[model samples]
Target: MPGTRTNPLRRLLVGRVQGVLNNRASGETPVVRSAHALYPPDSVIWRVHGDVTTMMIGGVTALLLQMLHPAALAGVWDHSTFRSDMLGRLRRTARFIAVTTYGERAAAEAAIEKVRSVHLGVNGVLPDGTPYAASDPKLLAWVHVCEVIGFLDAWIRYGERGMSLADQDTYVAQAGLVATALGCDPVPQTRAEAEALVAAFRPALTANARTREVARMVLTQPAPSLGFAPVQRMLMHAAVDLMPPWAKDLHGLHPSAIEVPVVRAGTMAIAQSLQWAFAGRATPRD
Candidate 1:
């Protein structure tokens, strides 16, 4: 009886996994058509972004980091429906990154234009009556730097171990193209420059009531499916662990020292499972 059930259960699991991996790509018009890929097969951006587990987890970390900026938080607060539509927010971001990094030049430019059109309508007043605009070059730069750095940091910590310094810089520079397209100015092309940009923005970053609420939502949101709940918890823990110490302090998160190793081990286990599940699958450029 156990043998009889094993194959069916395995098929069900694999089907669910395939659906997730195919998100936004299984459409009649895929966001990243293979022939139109901008990044070559061996490009650093492709390698860094191909890991689904790390990228999604890194996205959560990036969201928290980006919200630290008052203007950025105001944009989301006034314009985004993320409180009720977190998955939509995540999917749009994932699609943008996926398309820009792998889609043909024309398609990528189209995606950027779509985002810019949306940004044009997102300007509003903050709680203190200070004005904020999603398209503001300064705010765009903050969001872009936080996101790319978060991705690179996640890849380095969990996905790849021995990337050369040059390759790291290449990934940053390559990611900057999308940022520049979205109207962020002075995109950093090197690790040092990116780090300096982050440092410069630190003085303007703080955790406020809204930031804490968003962090709570990200960490505690129910998994989309019951089967993925355990994996999601592990991933969230890993994301929190990957955050800067100052960020942790800002959010009032004190992940127990003892829990760090446990979270890392669990996250790695999940990431490896994904790698195996996706074995022989197409890379981003493919």
Candidate 2:
């Protein structure tokens, strides 16, 4: 009540109601409901939904800026930190996917090594282990290319922000080379071909239930407990806050809405499960 004197009762009431409405809207709205239907009701759904929503809102904001103040937006895009953060996030996510999906630790290590072997290869380091050699520029290029492919997949499949026809082609070209370098074939040209490729890889994944379980666990974890969540949140907030005021007004996405602590918790649990499946004891803390 003391603080309420300055805040004003009317404004407080309105803010509280808006918060409730937003929460309900996020959960039960058509888009979110459709997302839940598309993804089995699981932690993966929550994580993906949150990510796509954030990206969509962010993309819209960027598009608005491009329309209203193209020069300003271009400047922001050209900022070194923006590129560094994006590359770092992609590299980290790619390593996680590679390690979990392949279930071949040595191959993952080798792939990272190959990326580092190239010139101008920054942001190609493994998340869990120290690099065996100095980062190679070529290796960094390969990693970034692979990440572009992954990002495109997420964008297309999940409706993430900022994906254009041009971006898709760029991803395809980069991914093709990266795949070839890794002795993996390029992604199929068509969606059908992609499906076939996925099916072909399905057996390997299924054969090792442990890997699938680990991936599932990671997918379900909440953000706060994840090693990367804090950093990710900070970046997300900064990106959102940097958008023009009108863009923020249009989207009405408060930064707090994107916060997901559960993701980290789920990842930790899954990591522990992976250890057990691999004949190792769960960590004492787990």
Best by TM-score: 1
List residue ranges in candidate 2 displaced over 4 A: 1-150, 157-170, 186-192, 203-209, 220-286
Worst 10 residues of 1 by lDDT: 277-286
TM-score of each: 0.90, 0.28
Candidate 1 residue lDDT tens string, 1-286? 2332255654464455444434544452444435567677678888888887889788988988898888898888778888897766776787788788777878888889999999899998877788888888888988998988889988888889787889989998988888888899879999989999999999988887888998888789877778878878898998889889998898998799899999988888878766655444443222
> How well does model 1 score by local distance difference test?
0.80
TM-score of 1: 0.90
lDDT, residue 202, model 2: 28
Q: Relative to the true structure, how large is the alpha-carbon lDDT of every model?
A: 0.80, 0.34
Per-residue accuracy of model 2 over 22-132 as CA lDDT, tens digit each: 334224221212221222233232232233223322332232322222222222233324333433333343333333222243544455455435322333222234332
Q: What is the lDDT of residue 99 in candidate 1?
A: 81
Q: Clashing residue pairs, candidate 1?
A: none
